[model samples]
Structure formats: C-alpha cells, structure tokens
Target: MLRRIEMRFLRPYLQEELKSVKMKSQIKFQIGKSGVTEGVIQSLNNAFRTRKTVRISLLQSSGRDRTKMKEIANELGDKLAGNFKHTIVGFTIIMKKTGARKPENKR
Candidate 1:
C-alpha cells in the first residue's frame, strides 16, 4: 500500500522532469566566459526577470573544461538560486526562477 502511494506521488514529478529536460535542449542563450563578468550577472538577472528558465551556452571563451563551467555555475548560485537549483550539462548552464520577473524599462 505504501509503495503504491509512493508511485502515484512520484509519477507526475518524473514525467514533468523529463519534459523539462527535453525543452532545455531545444533553446538556450549562449554566454561566454566573458559572461562570468559582473556585467553578465545583471544580464542573467534580467533574463530571469522575464523567463522562469534561462538556458546558457558557455562558449570556448567561457572555459574549455567542465571544472571551470562548474565554477561559473557556482558564481551564479546565490542570486540565481536560493537553494542551489542550477545545473551544468556539458558547457551549458540551466537556471530556473520560481519568483516573478523584474520590471522592464519603459523605453
């Protein structure tokens, strides 16, 4: 009985997660190591202001190794994810925001 209850609760979450993974592969913004700059944080913050998920492609300029990519993900951690919700796959970094986006300029 407990196992059946567990499956019922777990099934939807697993399906949704699979769908998100598929969506993540389709469209993602590209950011370079230069994006690691303070300037890029604002850009990312702005990007999240409008979208729940922001996908970034880390170019060769960002770093050629997975370790550097991990560092970049960590830097985007606090402001981006209060609970460490971001992840890096290959050179791509995916971020998700649950709160409302920031206000856009009128210009």
Candidate 2:
C-alpha cells in the first residue's frame, strides 16, 4: 500500500522531467565572399530548430564592405530569428584570433 502511494506521488514529477527541453548552441562560419549572406541566413533557418546563439566569423577579403556586413548582421537578428533574441559580434577585417597571432618582437 505504501509503495503504491509513493509511485503515484512520483508520477507527476517524472512526467514533467520527461518533457523538459534544452536549447542548442549554434556556430556558423562565413569566409569573406560576395552574395553569401542571404544564403547563409536561409540555411541557418532551415537548420536551427531550437533556440541558439550563433557565432559568425567573417574571414578576410580584398573587397569587404562594412555596409553589407552590417546589413547581414541586422537581417540575421531581425529576420532569421526575429522571434528569438540573438547577439552579433563583428571583427575588423583581417583580424586573427589572439592565440593565433604572432608574438611581438622585443626591440
């Protein structure tokens, strides 16, 4: 009789736990190229089903456009995941990860 009571009390908690949801982290890479922003955003929408924070790295290029870059970031935040919140971190052209940079030469 005691065991039956315990099982009944445990059932609701178990059900709630079974329905718990988790969000995934998304990382996207876009090498500096022309006409890729729209395509990338479309791909992200099709791929990311759960809420995710995307990190986009823009590699260097000869004709990188700041206006276009801002536009792409804005569209990602406004259109792709407009319902959800996101963050955009922009790096300067030709910037490398600090760890990958060469050590400074001492005079």
Candidate 3:
C-alpha cells in the first residue's frame, strides 16, 4: 500500500526505512520540547489532528520516567481509535506497524 507518514517535531535529518510500514496512514510523534514525558504526551494528544497511527520518539533525559514510554503506549493504544504501535530503543519509543518475525535459527 502507498503510505503517507507525517513526522512531527523530529530533527529534519533522521532517515527511516519505509520497507517495514504496512499502513497507508502513519505519523511519527517527535518530542520537540525539553521537558517531562507527560508534556510530550500531552503535546501529542493535542497535536494529533487525525486518527492515524502515531509513532512517538522520546528525547533522552536524566531521571526520566522509564515506565512513561510504556504508559504512553498503553494509553495511546487504549484511548486512540486507530492502531497504536510502540517500539522502544534505549529511552525513545517510535511507533510503527506491529510486525513480529522470529530470528531464523542458524546452525
């Protein structure tokens, strides 16, 4: 399918490979403010104009709530009408299609 992804608040240079996405309407949620994760979440909720899936990218910070990412993911999933996918690496969560493929066994 032809997908249209809107990346919000991201630094305008990060490259993402689009081979994994399976939806036609997808958006990336980027944390543009330097504050707590709650602010970011609020911003996302406030900023979301459409019901498309939103992938959030959190900014790394000291004393940040590690569980906040999970909380946000759960909240978005439960509260949003569209599909919600969360991918966490280090301290950031980028939402994407829920594609799970087990690693092939190499003998």
Candidate 4:
C-alpha cells in the first residue's frame, strides 16, 4: 500500500522529466579535411529546419587547435540562416537555434 502511494506521487514528475528530455531533438555533423564547405552549411541548415540543436564534431584532419575550432564555429553561426549560438566543448561544437534574430543597433 505504501509503495503504491509513493509511485502515484512520483509518476507525474517522472513523466514530465521524460517528456522534456524527448522534446530536445538533436543532429550531429562532422568537419573533415575539407573544412566548412557549402555542402556542410547546406546540410546543417536543412538539419536545423527539423531539429533544435546541432552537435558538430571536429575530426582530427580538421585540426584540433581550439582557436581554429572557435573560428569554424563562428563561421558556421554566421552562414546559418537563422539566429544561432554555439558552445565549444573540447573538439565538439554544440549549436542551438535561438528563435528570432536580435535587431542590430545602428549608431
């Protein structure tokens, strides 16, 4: 009886957590020796149409330099159609589409 009551209270919370996890759709891309090419940008744009997050892995051939990775991330962010922000973790770049572009201020 006690176990059943405990489960009933926990069930709703567990379901909500699971739903949140499932809702985050992600896609992965890799940068090879060719680096960031038009094909890559096109594919990433397509992926973003359906997914909210993109995980980009920098292959060894793509160079492991942290500064290079940041540059690539910035380039990708700029080329992408919508507003995006990226975070670099080791050789991986996690880019998420931030809805609505912020208006640029002109002096």
Candidate 5:
C-alpha cells in the first residue's frame, strides 16, 4: 500500500522529467547544394512531430551568406505547418515549435 502511494506521487514528476529530456534533445538536419527542397521540408515536418526543436546546418555548398540564411529560414517557416520560429546562429538554424495560444479578447 505504501509503495503504491509513493509511485502515485512520483509518476507525474517522472513524466515531466522525461518530457524535458525529450525536448532538450534536438534533431539535426543538413542543407547541401540542393538547398531546402521538398524532401527537406517533409523531413522537418516529420521531425517536428516527435521533437520540439530542430537544428539545421547549412553546408558549404549551400552558401554561408547571412542574408541567404535568413531567406531560407523565412521560406522554411512559411512552408512548415503550425507555429514555428527560427534563430540563426552562425551556419546553424535552430527552429523551435511554439505551443503558445493567442489570447482571445473579451468584450
């Protein structure tokens, strides 16, 4: 009886911890000469289903221009479903799925 009670209390905490670990581990994708093609978009969509964060690495052939990177990020954001925001750090683009809901105005 005591063990059952202890497990009941610990279950929620364990689940929360697991979720945090999962979110902390990000999936990585690379963009090569082909650039952000349909395959890449589809792969990112699939990754988002399991992960909250994704790291995209722009390869040398993809070009390292900051302006180009921003454009690619914007393009990906537009094509991807749901609310996803990206941050560009060097040649890596970190995209995170946001779960925030818009506030409804009351009259």
Candidate 6:
C-alpha cells in the first residue's frame, strides 16, 4: 500500500523531468580562431532570439585549452549580458537563454 502511494506521487514528477529533457532543443555553433568575434556574438544573439538553448563546439585547430574554453564561456556570458548563460558539457559549451535581464548601463 505504501509502495503504491509513493509511486503514484512520484510518477508525475518523473514524467515532468523526462518532458523537460525532451524539450531541450540545442543549436550548434563552431568557434574558430577569430575567437568569439563580433560576428560570432551576433550570430549567437540571433540564435537566442529564436531558440532557448545553444551548443558551442570548440575546434582542435584553434589551439585552446580546456580551462581557456571555460573562460571563453564566461566571457561570452558577460558579452551577451542579457538572458544568456553558459555551461561546458564534455568538449562542447552549452548556452541557455532565460528570462531577460536588465541591460547594464554602458555610460
């Protein structure tokens, strides 16, 4: 009886988690030696306009280290300065667009 009750309550939560996993749509972008240039950032911003999630893949020929990749992710987040946030997944960087944040005053 206790097992049945637990399962009933847990089912919806498990299903909801699975639904979220399935809903995560990822767009892929490859970073080159230009190293996150204005065009790169603009493209990323454009992708965020349409999709909530993006993946940034670093290439081997670029000669960047893993730690550097992480730093790049942080830099991108700062440059974006809006709804964008980043995470490093294996060899790829994953960025997600969340609720909009207030723009920082440049002046």
Per-residue alpha-carbon lDDT of candidate 1 for residues 30-72, written as tens digits (9 for 90 to 100): 7665666666777777766556667777887766676777777
Q: Model 4: runs farther than 4 Å from truth?
A: 1-26, 101-107
TM-score (C-alpha, index-matched) for candidate 4: 0.70
Candidate 6, pairs of clashing residues? none
Off by over 4 Å in 6: 1-26, 100-107
Which prediction has more favorable lDDT, 2 or 3?
3
- The TM-score values for the models, in the order shown, are 0.60, 0.42, 0.39, 0.70, 0.70, 0.66
Evaluate model 2: give its TM-score: 0.42
User: What's the distance in Å from true for residue 82, model 1?
Assistant: 5.4
Q: Report the lDDT tens digits of candidate 4 across residue range 1-107.
A: 53344345545865454335334534678898899999999999999898877788899999888889989999999999999977665577778788976699998
When 1 and 5 are scored with TM-score, the better candidate is: 5
Checking candidate 2 for backbone clashes, the offending pairs are: none
Taken over the whole model, the C-alpha lDDT of each candidate is 0.63, 0.45, 0.50, 0.78, 0.80, 0.71
lDDT of 3: 0.50
Q: Candidate 1 — worst ten consecutive residues by lDDT sum?
A: 1-10
Question: Model 5, residue 39: what's the lDDT?
Answer: 97
* RMSD of every prediction: 9.2, 19.9, 12.2, 11.3, 12.3, 10.2
- lDDT by residue (1-107, candidate 3, tens digit) is 11123343233442253223323435655553443356655655554544333556565543346677666567655654345566454455555434346799999
